[model samples]
Target: MNGVENNLDIKTYDIPTDSDPVHDNPIISNILLSRGIVDRKQADLGLASLSHYDTLPDIKKAVKIISLAIEHNKNILIIGDYDADGATSTSVAVMGLQRLGAKNVRWLIPARLTMGYGLNNNLLEQIYQKKPNLIITVDNGISATETCQTLSEEGIEVIITDHHLPPETLPNATAIVNPKLAENEFALSNLSGVGVMFYVLIALRAYLSEQKILTQKINLADLLSLVAIGTLADLVPMDKNNRILVHNGLLKIKNQQCPMGVLQICQIANINPADINSVDIGFKIAPNINAAGRIHQMDVAVECLISSNYETCNKKAHELKKLNNQRKITSSKMKDEAESQLIGIKKILNSHHDLFGICLYDESWHEGIIGIIAGKICEQMNLPVIIFTNSYDDNILRGSARSTHKINLKNMLDNFYQIHKDKILKYGGHAMAAGLSIKKDFLTEFSLLFNQECGKLLKNKSLKKEILTDGQLNPVNRNPIFVRNLQEVMPWGMGLAEPVFYDDFIVLSYKILQNKFTKMFIKDKNGSSTWNVIYFGGVIDTKKGDEITIVYKLSINNFYNKPDVQLIVQNYTLK
Candidate 1:
């Protein structure tokens, strides 16, 4: 591929000359077609209905079991995880059940620092105190086989609604509702934990309507706003099904039909709900909700989602904001320390040219922020990274792993477990991210073995970083209308990425903002027109009158209530 070298030693690939779809503006069509949206039919499919919800394995059974619980008025407790997905799933379950006329519904979430993950014996002891007649696990419980048995033995029927990969032996719950257990179709399998619970609620609503047990009309669309937030926050792949769900959910949020809590969160984040998009949810809103789980307790996030009182929701939103700010400071410190240690490790391994993975451990690192640190390091170095810190139990070190291109973190961990089963106590996650724990004494050995396996797996894979560009934007195409067309596409995330284009420009002037952000103005090669650009977390060392090549995404900046087109720089090469 033709490439341009950037100051960071990264290469930018030249835009491809692929066939494009027919649209009013060829620029938009080219961008869409480059992402595999070949025709109008495919574009329409992005907003298609989620018709495969009923085909999910065991969904009907789960609905039947939940309907019976509601009809019998049995006390039901929803067990949720501490992440955003878990918090939203808990809110969806509790609120949806109450709407279905269930009077004794309650919820519980495990504290990461104290209770750890999943429904274990310790959590079961706490659940026993509640003495509920039935238990519904959302976003978690797939791995809690013994916990399921304990609940069953206690005469509490268990309904498991999760999306995590199940183990060899399944839990003997009353009904297991998980998309991973269904056929491998994207629509059937890529549902997040909250997405799964939303489907269960859909089936339950239909069953209630069919059985003539409905006291009042319940529209499931009202809950799509929550599903959208949870789905975006979880970082799941945005397949057609997910895109549809998010598209519909965005409509609710844009129309101000979302819960008061969601509105409050948007307000605290300084994002106008009516103009929000997937990026806002992923960056601004999701972080605050996740912060409640990471720094404090997820109960604050759940309460923020389920509370109807505006004042209470606003108070919780502010609390989450505070926690998020604190989390940022902690994460920044951990990242600096990790980077420093990484430099030392590189010095030690200078003789090892085939190193493919990195493992770092420090008792001082906060367990709650290791994941974020690992992700940032992995992105910066383009290597698989596993960071460990002491768990509540000093004998074991809990770690979070993040992967780069062509590396499957889950598979790598599984292979490591196969060879050194005793070293790794437990591991679980998807291809790009995972979590595990190991004996503190085996850290050195485990690190060596992990790098060896990763090196073997990535021997032939390219490690060079490449910035892909859609194409050069024509002078006439750089306008607010183009930005509006981009927003019309609705949802964009994991699978369907936002568009980035590359072009050469003359640097007119630039100013530093907050010592971290760069605000600049650039003109076309002929200096006919200029565009405003903002680069976050990036520094430009070049001066005015210098020519440069930049890859950027089209964006809209609303200042003083007037929207103007702007470029958000991704990478740049000075000439």
Candidate 2:
């Protein structure tokens, strides 16, 4: 509101003048009050405050199946997806099963390039070759009805632990454990796949303890590091339950109680494990592990997560980092290509009048990176977006869709599937994001259908690119101490967003970094207070001596045990 419009809109929360909680830091108090949190005790992110695992529906059934398997030492196989959540879930299940007395436990993930999502025929055939007695699917299998049925008919007990929303017709597995199935029946509905798997392990431990079959005990907290990484990485709502898990897990990693690989990855990224925060997990650690899944096999990540050896974990960490480097390069190319396509779309925007959603595809785009591309474009466009690319099957294209609060992308895809049941190959996901496959020739038709469905969902709504901030920062608080204090206070994610402040500043100097980002030195307009700022988005239209309003989140640059406050620009208005 204070600078030139670059399609930027700013809204600020009304900070309380006098109702600050006396015990907490003032900055944290401001954030809490802004989120309507009056009682600090309500945000108890301690392990003891977690909701009881018994509240989840079908837990009894799932726990019984797993308990029976562990008692008999039956061959158990973990089927996981190819994401950070899936890797952590598989690691937790495999290690937890063995800890609980299961003798034979193994794990595998569906290769994104060779075997798309969920339990396809190829994945099923691969599973048959393993000849496991029971199969536990984590982060997937909620929508694999036919596969689950097929597995059931073959007498292989299947226990599905997922957090994704279920379809209209639920899968007929031996026991399906998903929070969405309960429809808010309990408070733990927002758990991630790894969280759900950890819950099963907790329930199994309880059952064993009750039945007097317990041999040795393990601190489930030992597994909390993996749970924390998976939960935060999944970008699920940072509800109190999840925050509790993360808070505990962060404690484990901070105290070096976690597996060697988790800490090694963090260190490799130059993050101090002792002072790690939410960003370290979401941005640095989790992404490296996810790289293996995106550019290579997630088995590399799972092995690291489940291992305790220092040297083995260190070697795996470097491999994951290498894969992440490759993914970043490929992703940048795909993103640039997608943006070029959008530029062309805008050229035809006048004829289209207004677009409610976006659908784009290119044969050159990598199938594994399409989801990230879709999410990035959705944020930039402020509308639901679906990105497609060549898939493993000839004549078929794989599409990943991301949606804003204006529309339910998953529901839209489900509707499209219902209407063109004969056209779609496969489809599944949650409310905000999902994936599907279709004939390459139907790309144009699918694009039109996607736009129509999104428009219908957003009947009278107009797209508005808005950023909410926590007012402006006081000059006195602009230092590394403030940044450190904010990071140490609480975790931030979907529900509790990281702190963002908007302020007007005059550019003292500017330079371009990596030929894309704009590195600037600016001083506050009112006060002479100055700090280094970096706009990682792109080159700006502003210049030296120009006064502009910018929204930014506070960051810290820690080098050799020394830290300095850094402003990472979110959006800026040029004057």
Candidate 3:
């Protein structure tokens, strides 16, 4: 079962924008305004308008230390996590440091299946062997309090650039540039791992330029493509500041001025560079990049992004494609198993015990992929979910959580940690998602407590998921040209969502794709015009000549060079 609620509601947004309508089409203007676009200034997503480096906490100190490392020719090793954000952050750090003349720079990313998440003992042992004079961490190290202390004892100075929520006791690093730090500006709040690294690189570049220490000048905008991919992949908020970063990055990527690896991945994913958007990265490129970390080691993915060789990126992209295929197969198997378990768990819900939080565990599951499964299940249940699998160690279990709007997951986890501090090995994440490790023996008790805590917070909240839409589409604005124009003002994601419109239609004909997705020929009931619609989930159970209403977004069909506009379904109702 798809688990999508057919009882959808259409809520037209009337939130006003500060300025006049920007787009020629009124529907487009209304859609933009609903997202609370303030003025033309926000619409102009140029690099000059990017937040200054000085705004980040410890920027000056971080730059000074990195500068000294470059000037003194000290060996510097970049420690990175094992996700897309981590891989891209490492790429930016390595490439930026090398460009700034740090000759002895190298990177060591943790292996997901073996080394666990961040700066654990396994990673620390490897770092110690490297014997680097300086260390820089990206996408991680915010919660590595004890690990950072160990590195300090080893006489290695660390500069941390991360964006995760910081722990109560911060890591003992020379400088921490996490935007989530209390001292940072609000503009930095939505910065992803790569975004933080980009700010650091810019700050270091500025310092070098001020000191007249650099002979060759380079524009850092070339790196925004990586920043965009990583930021979107991490699913960070798309606030105005983040929009500027992503918008500029898309410009560079579409213009073919980005790293060869990005273009190569796009080509392999069958994405046309001339017409790429945030959706392409979300659906096509990011998954392949993430697959390297989930199915294999991320070092190769990092190598692909940092390497300038055409043949190297080509080979790496193909390898990532293969990994992505494996990831899909494994993910499908896990998802099926999780769903089967959910069916059994629903019996408890039917017994009048409301399920506020869900905990699913399987020893045979792949730990690297639990987060994705948790997210999907959370969506299906409209509640908080934590999916756990057996860790590399025999006695431990690793869990990844995804939460609904009803509960603040980080706060709930913090409270749980406070009560059971000795039970959790490591736990840190944001409001929407988190990861943790614990003894496999505590699974039953932890699941009960988790459900209880979530029940407290979500007692008054409904478990049903809402499908919010941007009203109905005007017939005049439902053409290929207007849809193409809508694609221009993009980088839509969390905080700022893509527009969905609802309309009544007659299902003229329908065919099931792979017995899952439905491709239908729909005709506007108010007019004589007909259009193509692709319902993404399993079959909508509609047949020929059925009168129905469809909720959808206008999307471009990239079947060939000349793309056509089609409706991508979000929801539907039969009359």
Scored by lDDT, the top model is 3
Candidate whose TM-score is highest: 3
Model 3 TM-score (2 dp): 0.94
* Per-residue alpha-carbon lDDT of candidate 1 for residues 208-248, written as tens digits (9 for 90 to 100): 99999996789768689999999988888887678888888
The TM-score-based order of candidates, best leading, equals 3, 2, 1
Q: Candidate 1 — number of clashing residue pairs? A: 0
Tens digits of lDDT, candidate 3, 1-575: 46335565556767584569856567777787888875667777887888877878899999999999999999999988888899999999998898888999989998888787767677877887888999999999888888889989989999999988787899889999988885645877889999999999999998999999986796778899999999988889898889999998999998999989989999889988878888888889899999999989997788788889999999998999999999988987898899889888877576467778899999999887899899888876778999999987888889999997768888988888888878888787878889999888899999999988888887776555567889877777787778767877868887888888899999899888976678999899989888889986556787788888887888878675566779998777787
Task: List the candidate 1 regions with Cα displacement exceeding 4 Å.
Answer: 1-23, 45-48, 349-355, 512-515, 525-528
The segments of candidate 3 whose C-alpha lies over 4 angstroms from its true place after superposition are 17-19, 182-184, 347-351, 418-425, 448-457
lDDT tens digits, residue span 1-575, model 2? 01234777799877666664823677668787776566677666777888899888899999888889888889999999899999999999988988888999988798878886766567888888889899999999888898888888988888889998787998888898899899654678889999999999999999999888995676777789999999999999888788888888888999998877888888777777888999888889888988898899998998888888988888888999999999999988998889888878868877555677898989988887899999888877778999999886769888899988768877777777888887898887778888888988888988877777777778776566778899888878878887877876667877878889999999999997767778899999998989889876667767789998889999888756678788899888876
- 36 Cα displacement, candidate 2 (Å): 3.7
The lowest-lDDT stretch of 10 consecutive residues in candidate 3 is: 1-10
Of 1 and 2, the candidate ranking higher by TM-score = 2
Give the distance in Å from residue 570's predicted Cα in candidate 1 to where it truly belongs.
Answer: 2.4
**Which pairs clash (backbone N, Cα, C closer than 3 Å) in model 3?**
none
